[model samples]
Target: MCGRADDHFGPLGWQVLNGLFGYQGWELESMRDEVRPTDPIRFVRRTGAGFEAPFGRWGLVPPRMTLDEARKFATFNARIESLHEKPMFRAAFQAQRCVIPIAGFWEWPTSAGVKTKVRITRKDSKPLLVAGLWNCSQTPDGPLESCTIVTRPPTPDLIDVHDRMPALLLSRDIDAWLDAPPIRAREVALASWQPRILQVTPA
Candidate 1:
């Protein structure tokens, strides 16, 4: 499960976002070095006109759920295998797909009876675009948007680090992920499981 990540994508990262989605100068709610579940994070979602980047709670809150009830279960990571079968994710999976751009992510790997905190990032150091689903739920304060990262079985390179890894998209695949039909989107998700060079170091 990818429970922690970094969103401090600087100028170059912003350039990449601009190139991919034409993301203009929209401001983030907050940019953190370490973003945890339930914290506000930036994600790009499909809009009628185009794509828009917005801040949303890291844990997904289904439209039918109340904030109190949503807190009762783990909603930060949605398993790819059961997305269509799970009530909490089914609707969003079909319509509210999103991409979460992170500089890198953290994982704890156990070795020799010790757990080591490590950071995993693209070998090229480009931003990692994580596939996810988003939904809006009415809260007492108002409507709140939340998202859950999609996770699948780890690629061979990442198997030693964790049993699962965030489903990632290449820059070219973003359009299909956000605009394609559910069945086609699932194909894109499945195709993303190929191995890629990654840099993992002790954090």
Candidate 2:
């Protein structure tokens, strides 16, 4: 499962986002080098007019869940195969799909009875656009917005590192992944199982 991510995007990252969708008024003042579950992270979600980037908790909390229940829920990642069956993710999968842009992600692989930290990023060195689902739950403090990354079985090259990896979308497929109907979106999720190229090394 994809439990941690890196979000140290600088000027070049903003340039890529601008090239793809023009300027959407995104503020990354709180960006971090290491993002853990339950921490605030930014994700791009489709708005009625276009797309908007907003900070939300990394763990997803279903709209029907109470804050107390949400605290007990572990929803940092959702498995692609069961997106339509899980109560916590079903609604978001149908209409609240999102894209999580990260510089890379970290994984711990066991070797010689020891776990070593490894970082994975695109070989081309561009930001990764990972598929995700988001939802908003009302709370006394205000609306609680959260999101979860979608994971699939690892590709051949990454199977030794982890059994599951984030579903990463190509830049050209962003629109189809976000605007397509539920069925088409599901197809997009499946198609995004493997990225063009990935570089994995010790962190």
Candidate 3:
């Protein structure tokens, strides 16, 4: 269901605007195809409004992997329930959390090989927070950056299209995940009462 996301939009996807968000080994100047800050059109979700920090394309390559090895697996998805145990994601899962504010995302239903894309947006029409993990891994050239979105089991409405859905944090629950102690992070991620039961609108 969930696949590559085109987050290009306005007013909703900025974490830090007019600046670059770099971590320990993130190569600010040497990224493969870095986007300029002046570009009026780019994908972002406003964190506190007015801040836009462009991100590298989604998909993560753990630093431990070699060039050939990384190609085998790395995409825009991660299972929220197994993050702490998945070899490729555990380290970043514990250390590098991020917020992927979305206008919405796409899911596709495929029969044999043909696919039909469906847009899934929030019923309330507000941006949704998708939990993420980021990493800057060592490559032959140097360190390269990548990220992955966390996912949970699909809700009933979404099950028809895909077996799983991205791990989404409700507007009321964003702070709870980001600020919660480690012991509570897992619990918060799996909360049923928060009800991520979003009303889906066809795009």
Candidate 4:
């Protein structure tokens, strides 16, 4: 499971978004090097008019789950295999799918009690638009919006780094992955998702 991400794309992040989603506006800046759960991260959402980049919390906090309750349990990464079965993600999986634009992500490759941190990025060094699910919850203060990255079993090349990786979508598949009916969206993404080899070990 991925718990941290790096979105230091700076001005280039908008360019990537424009290229992928044809979004013409900008309301976000470069995020911190490590964006953790509950942090406001930039993501793309489809509106009735079109798509736009907006800031959303990195954890999935459904309308029924209080922020306090969600914080106690891990709701950052939704496993693809159990998306429909997971109580925390089922509704969002069906109606609130989104795309998280990221530079790359970090994972703790563990063996026994020992752990090593590694930064994973595509060999091409291009930004990755990761698949995710989002939801909005009403709170006393206001409405709280959050999202979760979708994960699938890792390909053989990435199994050593982690057993699961963020479900990835390519440029051509982004439309269908977002516009298709919820179940079809999942199927489309799973069918077209490509596993990339990452080699950005950062100090």
Please give each candidate's TM-score: 0.94, 0.93, 0.68, 0.89
Candidate 2 runs further than 4 Å off: 24-30, 193-196
The global Cα lDDT (0 to 1) of model 4 is: 0.80
State the lDDT at 84 in candidate 4. 80
Candidate 4 runs further than 4 Å off: 10-13, 23-28, 111-114
> 1-203 in candidate 3: lDDT tens per residue?
25644443333223322222222222222322212211111223334533333454466777677646766775567888788888888887676666565556776677688777677766655555676666767778876666677788876677667888777776566555655664466566666324445655444
Between candidates 3 and 4, name the one with more favorable TM-score. Answer: 4
Q: State residue 114's C-alpha deviation in candidate 2, in Å.
A: 2.0
Per-residue CA lDDT of candidate 2, range 48-142, in tens? Answer: 77778888999999978886787797899999889989999999998999999888999999989999999998786778899999998889999
Candidate 1 backbone collisions, by pair? none
Candidate with maximal lDDT: 1
Better of 1 and 2 by lDDT: 1
Using lDDT as the measure, name the better of candidate 1 and candidate 4. Answer: 1
lDDT of 4 by residue, 1-203 (tens): 78999887656665876777776454355457898888898778898867876678888897688999999888888888888878899888777888888888999887787888889877766678788888888999998878889988776668888878888888787877777887788786566656554664844
Q: Which run of 10 residues does model 4 get worst, by summed lDDT? A: 23-32
* TM-score between candidate 1 and the true structure: 0.94
Best by TM-score: 1
RMSD of candidate 3 to the true fold? Answer: 7.4
